[model samples]
Target: MVEAAAPAASVVETVAETEPPATASAPAVVASPAPSAPAPVARPAAVEKPVKPKPEARLYRSRTLGQWIKRVVLLAVGAIAAAAILILAARGVTTLPGVPEFLERYPGEYHLPATAEPGFPWWAQWTHFLNFFLIVLIIRSGYQVRTQQKPPAFWTPKRGGKKISINLWLHQSLDILWLANGLIFVVLLFASGHWMRIVPTSWEVFPNALSALLQYMTLDWPVENGWVNYNSLQQLMYFLVVFIAAPLAAITGVRMSEFWPKNAKTLNRIYPVEAARALHFPTMLFFVLFILIHVFLVFSTGALRNLNHMFGGTDVVNWVGFWLFAAAIAITAAAWYAARPIVLAPIAKLFGQVSSR
Candidate 1:
């Protein structure tokens, strides 16, 4: 029994020695991974820039008084320089090429006799004043109408259909009145035998006008005898104003108005709106120039005498004419100041439909 127990114990010990430890024998279990930080988020690309918008176009540009004054000064200077150059060239300046021989011709060769006559009559004086008043109104309204991009007030005739601006309505209304006045004046002038003063009987007036122009440029104005006879230049200018420029202005103005034939496409195509516009604007400028020169001469030559002829209807130099002239001028100035849109709108409403745009 001892030997059998010893053999059994030896067998057990042998088996234990052959087998590995329980920890070594067990399968290896992977350790649970440690929790990791959230993956870094990708940043967005740089924001794109916005595009800029384009600027709008302008219809009219505003200018300062200084700029206008500068422009006038420059224009005057240019005119004077050009006149000087022309005169020098005409006088056979060796440096000047292509100078016309006619430029060198003096007006004395074509002068006409001054017909002795009484100064301005009462009708003449009254018509002159009327013309002056109408012209002033016409010019003011015309400028306003021309420059306006947006009409503050629009006008339509009682008949309706076509619409016109208040400024233009005023201009056209004044124009109609002026035309009537001009026609009456013309008729009266012819009946009174005063048409001879303005109308040229012969072609000789051309050279005389040139001479007068030369005299004016040289600061040697022609002898003042408007009471008796106007210089050839004066007569020509008056003729042009009365016959050419005035009619041109009227015609061009009408062509632009509603009165013109709209459906006359072929006629319109031939006599384009652009042509009428070109003629009209320049005609207005011509009238402006004539007024400026006329006023300057009236004041500078003999204020009292000139005033007497136009206002008092006499050749006699007196303060009575001057006083009347001053009063007329004052009235004109007041009218000019009062010619605002507020005032003009009411006047326009009487003739047509007036409404704020």
Candidate 2:
């Protein structure tokens, strides 16, 4: 037993000798740091694009030439339709009760007074021509004076009371001529016993005038015998134009003119310039209408004979009066064209000092 114990103890002693010895404190431990997170990337900030501004809208829409043409066509068609309707309506009116009888009884005219003279005199023809020339110039200058924004030339009188526009000067000058011509025409008319033809003698004129109007409207015009005696409608129109309209025009014109007495406060109050202005334009419009109607009637009803009565002082239908009328129209047109500042300034300088300012 001893031998076996001795062998086991020797083996333990050898293993104990081969084994490493432990110290009083264990060796200090060394730990490695953990891996850090990756640095954040810095990208360029997003760039903003500029926005475009919108355009402003127009006030009035532009129209094509075609649109204007369409409008003009519509107006012309409308006028034609209206005329057709009026003619149809007038024809229909003739069929009404008592209308036909009334038209037949009157026959559009009444007998002239015993003192009335037949046919136009040579003086009447001359006066008519003078009136036409003066009136044309008056209307042209008057319109220019009214509508001109800037005067081309101004006139200062030799005595120099006030500065007046060239157009106004022309208008005033023409007015004087017209007044003189009118006065002469009036004197001649009475002296020649022609006033009895135009002045109404009886109340039969009213019915005759109505009958004449109806006849004209129905396109069945009455017989025109202006040389022997004017129709009642014609007589009334002539009287109104010569008496009522002429006097009214003259009074209103005088009130508006520089010749009026500015110091006469009472007269000015009684006949205000405003009233004169109001009446003057309407009177001009009336004259325009009368002239247009008269010219149209002259051309439509016996053009040659009427032209001869006025222009040739005879009732013969010939080209002599027509040629003379054409020449008169040419002369009038030349006068109109020559009424500009360029031509008028020279004439104006003869009487007054002309200036642009």
Candidate 3:
């Protein structure tokens, strides 16, 4: 029994020696990665404001009302003073050696037969009004054109060569109308036997006209018998206005027009443009003078009667002629004021391109 127990103990000891022994483990220690910076936030752009445009400038600013009034008053005073001075001087001059004899020798004559002729006819009245209207417009526009630095528009024909200013175009147009009217008046005057009233039939008219001038200068106004026969002075003046000034104005205007060939050196030399320009201005002045004197005489002699004779075709004094004359004057005033670039540009555009600077 002792030997079997010893063998069992020996087998247990051998198994223990062959097997590995176990041991205790510590907790693992690991560090985490650092946090990265937050991403940058984006900003919006700044806003901007808009800008405005500037206005265009003008060439010449017009004079004020006060300025014009002052000028007119000064002009009237100066004119009166000058005329008085001249007459006084002339009186003193007449006392000198040969002046008295010369004046006496040239002192004119006056003769008028008794006749009550029909005054201005209806056609004559209308034409006269038209002439006045056109002349006023022409003068006003001409002054504007002369003063203008830049043309508001230009006219280029389909068959184009040189371009013309809108104002010049208007001037030419008015001239054409005036010429046509004058032609018609001439025809009618001759056909209706009215030419005899203006045309000088006798050499004595010259002396008669000179006498009338002397009478006028002396302020002893001769009797006016226009219903039957115009004074020799009146006849001469009418003849000059109708035949001489009218044709001269037309000729000069044409010479300075675009229709005049610039290349025609020979023609230009014979009838120079400079000469035309000079004559044209003087002719316009003459017309203006005639109009002023004519108006003064008519009003001074007899307002209603003269107006009736020219406008109403009657010798009787009435308000009809005055009213018509007033209306005509009003229309002329309106036209004169309305002839600015703003009003004329559109009309000018009908013919060609109208561009403003």
Each prediction's RMSD to truth: 8.6, 11.0, 15.1
lDDT of 1 by residue, 247-311 (tens): 99999999998889999999899889899999999999999999999999999899999888889
User: What tens-digit string does per-residue lDDT give for candidate 3 at 268-328?
Assistant: 8999999999999899889999999999998887888888877788888789889888999
lDDT, residue 171, model 2: 94
Model 1 ranges off by over 4 Å: 1-61, 64-117
- Spell out the clash pairs found in candidate 1: none
lDDT of 2 by residue, 70-125 (tens): 88899999989997898888889989998889988999999887778788998888
TM-scores for the candidates: 0.73, 0.79, 0.72
Sorting all predicted structures by lDDT, with the top scorer first, yields 2, 1, 3
Steric overlap count per candidate: 0, 0, 1
**Pairwise TM-score winner, candidates 1 and 2:** 2
Off by over 4 Å in 3: 1-75, 85-117
Worst 10 residues of 2 by lDDT: 55-64
Which is superior by lDDT, 2 or 3?
2
Candidate 3: residue pairs that collide:
108-211
